[model samples]
Target: MTPPEHGILGRVAGAVTGKVVDAVPVEEILEHVDLDAVLDQVDVNHLLDRIDVNRFLDRVDLDRLLARADVNALLAGVDLEDLVQRAGIPDVVASTTGDLLGRTLDVARRQVVGLDAVVTGLVDRLLRRRGPAPLGPVLLVGER
Candidate 1:
């Protein structure tokens, strides 16, 4: 027989055989296959690279998925005491307080320096004044 005749015969035989077989028999047949060995032979990175992530994300409902999650139960699994112990809050607070106080003192020093300049300028002008001071007037030193 020709190859076309063989192909037609094969399709007819496959259709007849597929009608007799079901999912349970398919599962039994697959039970004999070593899935772990098959997976080990496959390139996972190549397989993942072929997947359409955007199409997968488009089908996902994030809100509904999150709603199904037990958040309080998840939180309960976390050890808060352990987390706090690991955080070292006292050391952090001390370092932060020291930095804030240092910054504040620097600003205060700048303001004091500015005040000293103003006071020194006033004193120099008063010492250099030549004209007679106005009587009963609120006199700015050295003003004509």
Candidate 2:
């Protein structure tokens, strides 16, 4: 039969339901229930499909996550030698140093050549010898 609709019986049923609900111990009822059994009846994939992932992620606290990280200990765990080897830093440094040493030697060689030229000019002036500073170990007719 249909439930009572808007009459003395409906009012009386409402009053009785309210009293019964008030008298019931909801906490005790919950304690008697098996949560695993309830969960087994749930459709997890359907629940996941209904969830808004981006909205859920927006509620995450990123600062609190970073605060839990140990940065100093993380750095201490790194292998610097392995890192340098992987990056080929030693080869780069060796090539750069080799180029620097070569340039330095070239500069020193040029300076020594300039000093030799100056000494040759001075000797030619003193001996009254002219003809292009005696030209590489070959003596002129006026000298031995």
Candidate 3:
């Protein structure tokens, strides 16, 4: 088959297979094949045949979906004042708290090989410390 034809077939197969996978119970999917095998082998065209496209499309609201995404919520929670404080540092320093932490780790690794850069770096980091707000905790949730 031509490359274009192959690509189209792949997309169709993916859509159908995805639907089939979603509709099938998790236990039944495992009975047929492991998760990876089922994901790799299921044909999307077969899935499409068993599901209603119009109904599926009707159930999806693109705007509402994007609004519910975690990244958007995180961005909304960002405090401008906290960001401004974090951005300021002593003139001699060339790093943020995260950058200093990474640099300190690198220095420690080098020290293990008889090369030390920790003392000066630590002093610089201390001098550059800006009282920034505490970052909020991240919560991870599994699907029910």
Candidate 4:
């Protein structure tokens, strides 16, 4: 190839090129550029392979990020039952609930049985019927 141009002609050419470059608006230049053709020349996967995710995370300000976060939005996104199960609370809740339910049913059953016997006795006396008009069903008595 020819030797590098020097002297007055090269300096004039360089000055004119610099002026033209300075005059072109970057946005107009970008509009004229073939962006798809430029992107096709890039190696996206190779660029991504060079990133250190752990090191990147280490540099992140998690406390600051959390401070800026919408607590209500985050709560809305969460599954409370899943979170409770993950924290190992479901077994305790289930056992406590089961015990509470058993106690409640026992109290209710006793109340109903007592009320039923009282009503039966009152009806038996009014009709002048036999001893105890049976509390609940007579199914068990006949079976015996």
| Candidate of highest lDDT | 2
Model 2 spans > 4 angstroms off:
1-69, 138-144
Candidate 3 displacement at residue 6 in angstroms: 39
Itemize residue pairs with steric clashes in candidate 3: 13-44, 16-44, 16-47, 16-48, 17-44
Q: What is the C-alpha lDDT of each candidate?
A: 0.81, 0.86, 0.71, 0.85
User: Tens digit of lDDT per residue, candidate 1, span 1-144?
Assistant: 235766978878877767757534888778888999988999989999999999999999999999999989999989988887799987798999999999999999999978976776687588986555343235644444
Ranking by TM-score: 2, 1, 4, 3
> If both were scored by lDDT, which would come out higher, candidate 1 or candidate 4?
4
- The candidates, ranked best first by lDDT, are 2, 4, 1, 3
Q: What alpha-carbon RMSD in Å does predicted model 1 have with respect to the real structure?
A: 9.9
Stretches of candidate 1 above 4 Å error? 1-60, 129-144
Colliding pairs, model 2:
none
RMSD of 2: 6.8
lDDT tens readout by residue for model 3, 5-54: 66988878888888988999878877866678768888988988999889
Residue by residue across 26-78, what tens digits does model 2's lDDT show? 78767878999999999999999999999999999999999999999898989
* TM-scores, all models, native as reference: 0.43, 0.51, 0.21, 0.40
Instruction: Point out where model 4 deviates above 4 Å.
Output: 1-19, 82-90, 93-144
Provide the clash count, candidate 3: 5
Task: Please tell me which model should have the higher lDDT, number 2 or number 3.
Answer: 2
